[model samples]
Target chain A: MNGVKRLSAPLNEKQLLNLRAGDEVSIYGVIYTARDAAHKRIYEIIKNGDKMPFDPEGQIIYYVGPTPPRPGRVIGSAGPTTSCRMDKYTPLLLEKGIKAVIGKGKRSEEIKKSFIENGAVYLVALGGAGALLSRHIVRAEVIAFEDLGPEAIYKMEVEGFPAFVCYDLYGRDLFEEGIKKYRKE
Target chain B: MREVHWERISKAVAELFKKINYYLNEDVYNALKKSLEIEESPVGKRVLCQLLENAEIAAEERIPLCQDTGIAVVFISLGQEVIIKGKNLEDAVNIGVAEGYSEGYLRKSVVRDPIKRINTGNNTPAIIHTEIIPGDKIKITVSAKGGGSENMSAMSMLSPAAGSEGIIDFVLETVKRAGPNPCPPIIVGVGVGGNFELAPLLAKKALLRPLNEKNEDEFWRNMEDILLQKINSLGIGPQGFGGRITALKVSIETFPCHIASLPVAVNIDCHCHRHWTIEI
Candidate 1:
């Protein structure tokens, strides 16, 4: 097992890469939720020099669009969406002080390069493990784009939300590394 | 012609939507469990465990197996001798979908338009495909395809000269390019020898096959084994953490095509592979 360090809500790139795909992570802190629509809006904000709704510094963004919760529930099955869809907007967020991204799937080369240059890291939560992920989110509220429905930007407070480091600041990728180690000769 | 009751059909469809969202099919569940035993990498084994646990929790809690909840894709095989009664068949199906999605708390992932995309609110107007079969009994299959894996599906028309080797190459290329994006340890559904559009449909239909079941035809059976071996060799492993089991299974369905054309379509289902069938 790799060494695990429990840090505060906002984690740095070095701290993020310490995670591997199967490694269990307990993320305690603030995280933001954004899907395709919200991503486009965030990009527009960056392009127009507008202030983002939440502070990006040391923040982690989760790429998810959750189901509407039932009565007396915080939120419905909340799992990560494919991360590659956010590739275009990710570099921009990292440039603005965002330290980490949490989602599924491999990111593009451009996004990975930005991760190295800007000291950002990518984390992955199990894609279909919605109920499992939902157990981590203690609280959630829409911070922006309410009309976007599930795609709305929501600030979520999670306790011990599990994730793995898929991409590290050093440009090493778990997807690539795992394949090399396990592929038959 | 015998009349079919829309209300009954609607209720059955609604139940199907709910049951599939809450329950992972037995074949898929068993396959995931088996994957853990054969998976070589430690990380891969962990991922498989989480998936298995997730399936159990989702089923027990009656929650969606995945957050995306997927765009509702229904395949209906109707009996030609059956006639519809009461409400319009299409409307009933749509209502069933809306109610099922709302009642089950499945996410409404569908949008109004692809380019000008707007949330449809209730996940209504399911993408329903209907075909008239020879039997009097209506068979319906529901597959909740998550966006991540759906986005990775691809289709191509190869020259008739390409043959099985060419088809295998295309499938491998598509999986490699998809990488971790499609959610690794995927089930690859390959449809070969049909027309352009039919090829994709056949590919998707192939996914409904039992996970461990082999094709009856020896040629297709060999193709399935070869593809499965090649895919796992890619080392995409569970959730792309890199492992021996890049794919849990590779299922192929084929039809005779024109002499000049060879159509191939690949549909990828994530490990969740949420699906169920109901007949009423």
Candidate 2:
């Protein structure tokens, strides 16, 4: 096992791919938060030739739907939701120059391929670790679709936000490799 | 007949919402801790470690275990002899749900319609299933079901000839297909026998049981062991990182069904497994 790294956020695509499973990384800086609804909206925007809510180039998208914060808190229980649900919209985002995605669970083959081809990476935060993750989010504000409730797009500033690289730019998936190594006869 | 105080029930229900959200039940917490010890894959073990730490932080900070606090699903067993005082039982339950989610700051994840997808702001109108049982006390089991795991649930009605082997295969296949999507290692609640909807209902009900608690019936006990072995063999592991334990536990609940039907339902619950029960 290698020691964890604390990289300032807004990391480039190549920087994200350098992260690997079992390697702890604390991210600092700006990240966009969105889930199924916002992903759909983003895709719709792309399909309609409309401008996106945020620039996708060199950006990291986090797949999350946080609970409403308590008084004085920035966000609530801000953990990653399952990533597979956003598979359909991911390739579209990658095409627009999105560098990385942060979420939990395995992605589809198409999404995995798109990451490799587009020089993007898929990072996985611990699912169900909402409270722990929320602690890292220093500030949060809705950037778009406030009416989507928790599923709305939010721009978040995080410090020491922990994540692991589930899929790297080199076309390797930690999930697949782990399964092969541990599968029972 | 025992008089049931609607106010008391509402209070209990209200607290049920917050408790289910803020705290990871002891069984689930302990199971996760155990998983960290037994998991063989380095990545899987690390994921489990993070999960255990997350539970502690969530409870101490009084925050939800997951961002998707999930739809409020309650199983109420009302004593037949109890009489509700002052309010309609259904309305009382809904009010409790609304108050709990709003006041507790839990996410309102429910939608008014699946198609139109209107947000029901306060997570009201809980999916309440009430059964009248012979007792003077009312029992309520609160389960905050995450969409990720609930979406992975599946049910099937096979020919009676397919039998237990078919039932086991169906459950294993469903989990394998789910892969990392449902957030393994998951707890699988299996309902055998019963009709179409009832089978799934039974499976969901079985989830209320503590993790790793074996069925008391000898026949069901053996079945549980076999299923547990088969599921772990899939190597889905924690967070699907892959390990020796794909499933923390498999609980089966059954009832006699129509002779022509061998209905089976598999209800998958993520590692969070947030649930709590209250008897009032």
Candidate 3:
């Protein structure tokens, strides 16, 4: 519980500059969702200089592909997918002014360096905690690439969406530093 | 010979798939609980707690524990004295899988073709493995294997000279390389001594074993224990946040292989570890 930070999304430089690798944070706001298929499409749009489905400036993109929601629910089990798969498309999104990225697992060194150059942050959510995470997302609607099924881009409003900064602007990696303290071999 | 109706197979398959995806197996749940007790890092503990709560929520709500409800991997053991009636056995299972995925609100992850990548929509045509056993009863095991962990699966056809030391090193290398990608505190299923294809199958089958149960052979049991410690010592931890418990269990299954080959495979299952069995 100690030292956990609370911040709202669509963040600014002041909010991000203070964050460091390994810092726990609970985010509150709307976050755009995109996984492998959606990222590929989004990359194509950016490469063609077409307007993005949603403005990337000062926003967060969560890598996820959730299940179909039941009759009464706002969303289905929606947790972060692996982030490494999106490394190729990230720099373009970052260049467009996105503030943060959320997903599970390690990102490549190149992506970490990208974060530094772009002054952005990488937040790692608890992977496989879909059921728990869904409770935090109050609303979700597909905004683009509707034919992609689960991979469609979704606009979601979340509260207390928990994550930890895995990479910050300084290029410190939580995965590398976190393992150093615990590895015996 | 007992006649087992195909409709019964389809019904059981549908129900079992739904049940396993929504409610994680008891053995897997207990392993996570125990791991939580031993897990030291605050971040690791937090992740474990989230997983524990996620399982509880999924069970109570009748929703999947994870969104990637997985490709249905059905292991069917048919009695030598039984005959299947109604539809073809494989068709019946596929029907059941499609119905279950749709009805249960599970994600339809299977696609028609690997390269073309169009969703099969109903999650149909399960990966079915059948075998003949001596008894008169039909036993079915359904495991919803998520892609995250399945992507981390590894195999190597090491030379006979590589021996135990070589195999252990491979296991470590694979797990370390997998890191957080497979979702940590993973169940490591290792297959040793089978032929090229069978080795990987054995690895996947090894995951179905109860989490607490050690290998029946003392030699392999020792190997499991040694591997578990070595893997945990790597410090990947829960979701690779870094802690004491990187893997909840290491299960090894072996079979006789050719003298010239030492085939091995590692199939990683995430902490969700959704699988169930039924006999009818």
Best candidate (score: lDDT)? 3
Error in Å for residue B211 of model 1 = 1.3
RMSD of each: 1.6, 1.5, 1.1
- Report, for every candidate in turn, its global Cα lDDT versus the true structure: 0.85, 0.86, 0.91
All candidates: DockQ: 0.82, 0.78, 0.78
Give a tens-digit lDDT track for model 1, residues B1-280: 7788888777877788878777888887888888888988887888888888888988888888788888888888888888879888788788888888888888888888889888788897788899999867788888888888988999999998888889989999999888888787799999998798899999999999989798899999999999999998888888888888888889999999888999999999988887777776
Interface RMSD of each: 1.1, 1.1, 1.1
| Best-performing candidate as measured by TM-score | 3
TM-score of chain A of each: 0.93, 0.94, 0.97
Better TM-score candidate (2, 3): 3
Chain B TM-score against the true chain B, each candidate: 0.97, 0.97, 0.98
Per-residue lDDT tens digits for candidate 2, residues B215-250, read: 899999999899989888887788887788788899
The residue-by-residue lDDT of candidate 3 on B15-119, one tens digit each, is: 988898888788888988998889888888888888889999999888788888889999999999988998888998999999888888989888899999998
lDDT of 3 at A154: 96
Docking class of 2: medium
lDDT of 2 by residue, A44-69 (tens): 99999999998877888999989999
Off by over 4 Å in 2: A13-23
Candidate 3 segments whose C-alpha is farther than 4 A from its true place: none
